[model samples]
Target: MDRNFARALSLVLKSEGGWSDNPADPGGATMKGVTLANFRRYVKADATKAELRRISDDQVAMVYRRFYWDAVAGALLPDGIDYAVFDFAVNSGPGRAAKYLQAVLGVVQDGRIGPATLAAAGAKPAGVVIDALCDARLAFLEKLPTWPSFGRGWSARVASVRRQALLISAAPLTTTVSVPSAPASADAVAPTAPPAGAGPHTGAEAPAAPPESVSPAKAAGILALIALALGALTAWAAHLPCNLLGVFCQ
Candidate 1:
């Protein structure tokens, strides 16, 4: 019901930390969880591993906010569910993440997070959705050929994501419409899924989807630091004081 991009992104970055270029990784090489392709499209066309390794936090945040977070409609989604889906989108491909989320919601398995999906997701409690979505995500990952190498790490990540997502759902979330994975499996031909939050693009999802529209809430909390920079992307009314969930705290 509100925008939680900053908070959500912060949590995700905790998991994405640093750079890695496992040759077994289908996404090739990545920096701060971004694939070489995404870096090329967003920051540099001729971006090299060296440049990717040194990607600034600002750039990393920009890519995740516009691509991964927004693609999963993080701003519109409930707190915990928003994080769960965003992390899922980052770890697996956004298309597959959206479909799994829809599966939990019993909505059509279209790989997009449109109004219908929003409404369905909103109707359910964020905690329940987080649990179901995480379970489903693990189930899918467990069956992958790479599970032997990444399964334990993936399970740990999903557990942590579930735990944190539930915490967000429990707390009143307030960051509202903000920006916006990785993967392979039985659906190898389906969409790309980064090995456990490894990347954020896959499947039929466009490299970038327009950030979902969201209603503005009073900019509460101290983290409105980027309110100005975000501009039209996700501006909170700084004058009014509200909690992270956009509700008056006391």
Candidate 2:
């Protein structure tokens, strides 16, 4: 509500030019065909539309609460950037703009846009689109007689909201497990250690030692068993006789 804050905000938004052209700009020249009173009437009528109402203050505030970062202070970005991002979110949907900002800022690439993404975006070099938007907001703000005072209050609110957004965005993320070693080789197996307080043999009965060598016949028998099980399953599935049907099917 500080007048100075509004003035500063108005200055920043006014400096950016294209904002006056926004469809939401109450005084846009594009709406000149309609009288001011008629325009207001149309706005009131449109406000009743479900889609417009869906994008009401509550929805916008929800999104604002998600991305507004205050703690970093004004150092992360100018007041214009905050206004621009919020407007972009409201107009284009927060998810898309957040993703675009993430891409612009080189943050995590998951596209569900949010505060961390916007903060990251603030770190990006201003591009053509960003510059144009900043210009528009600045231009729009500058034309308003009350902009100085209004902008100050709006900027303060934005700052507070941004702080909340940052906190939400900074919440601890879920963690994942990490294995310390590579998978064991096909031929390698885990070694069993002797139990505590035992002699060389150990306290409890020692595990059976692994075989030093494997016989070809034993391996062949194991393969035969596996083949038999697979044959049975195939026979059941095909509803065929086990032997001849199995050979033909293969």
lDDT (tens digit, per residue) of candidate 1 on 1-250: 3367888788887887778899877778887789999999888999998999999989998899778887888878877888899999999989999999999999999999999999999899888889999999999999999999888988999999999888888775654646534554544553444477565555555455559765455344333656655764444555246745577654
Give all TM-scores, in the order shown: 0.67, 0.25
TM-score of 2: 0.25
lDDT of each: 0.84, 0.44
In candidate 2, what are the lDDT values of residues 86-169, reduced to their tens digit? 444433344544454455456785655456755665565434335544444444455667666456644454444344334322
RMSD of 1: 36.4
Clashes of each: 32, 21
Model 1: how far is 134 from its true place, Å?
Answer: 0.5
Model 1 clash tally? 32
Query: Best candidate, lDDT-wise?
Result: 1
Query: What range of 10 consecutive residues in model 1 has the weakest lDDT sum?
Result: 214-223
lDDT for position 51 in model 2:
36
